[model samples]
Target: MSSLQSVTDDTFDEVVLKSDLPVLVDFWADWCGPCKMLAPVLEQLAAEQEGKLTIVKLNADENQEIARRYDVMGLPTLNLYKNGEVVKQLVGAKPKRLIEKEIAEYL
Candidate 1:
């Protein structure tokens, strides 16, 4: 089982936006290659960061409304939500180290 939680448009607000911990929302699609590449890295981070951060996956294809609301134009786009707002955005498949470094401050 993966540590990452799956969030749909219906649960998105309560799960990610209203989360107590910082939320890393991964916007991805089934056919996105880079999204597949980044999944394991995110899973690892979700496990390692446990209490410090909350990581969730949102299918951009299935939940196009939320994706468009957030202006996600690419696959594997990581949007860090803090206090119901996006604080940082990473728009590609990146190494775990790079991902960590990018969102370190927010974590």
Candidate 2:
């Protein structure tokens, strides 16, 4: 099973935008309660969807440039990127099944 990877502003381009596999970029911050709540669900999804998708966490506080670029206004925002563009965006903490369902078309 694959584990979620952390990406910084400097690495976001190479790690996510250039990745061959679709990426689920979770935009979060340390003090956000919902972000904490969604962490485990993301971990499970990351493991289950290993080859099909890559799950990465980006700290909004630390990677403000990337966050602003993506227009992330909320914590725990999930942006699914394909071919270097955002294919879907899900805001707030969501259940694993719902998250999966939301991105099912991409998968």
Candidate 3:
């Protein structure tokens, strides 16, 4: 199983923009409470989706350049990308099913 991967400004292109499967990127920062809440949900999804999807984490604080490029307005913004372009964006903490539903179109 490909565990959830991390994307940095330097590696975003290779990991996310070029991924074969739809990529779910969780943009978070260390000090954000909602980001903390969403982290475990992402972890569970990472394991559940093992081969069906790709999950990546990007630290908003550390990867400000990438975050700016994507226009992340807030912490814990979940962006769904397919073929190098963003298809959907979800903000704040949400249930796993809701997140799964948001990406259903991509699947």
Clash count for each candidate, listed in order shown:
0, 0, 0
lDDT of each candidate versus the true structure:
0.93, 0.93, 0.89
Provide the lowest-lDDT 10-residue window in model 2.
1-10
What is candidate 2's lDDT per residue for 1-107, written digit by digit as tens? 22578999999999999999999999988899999989999999998998999999999999999999999999889999999999999999999999999999998
Pairs in steric clash, model 1? none
TM-score of each: 0.96, 0.96, 0.93
Error of 1 at 69 (Å): 0.5
Clashing pairs in 3: none
Winner on TM-score (2 vs 3): 2
Ranking by lDDT: 2, 1, 3
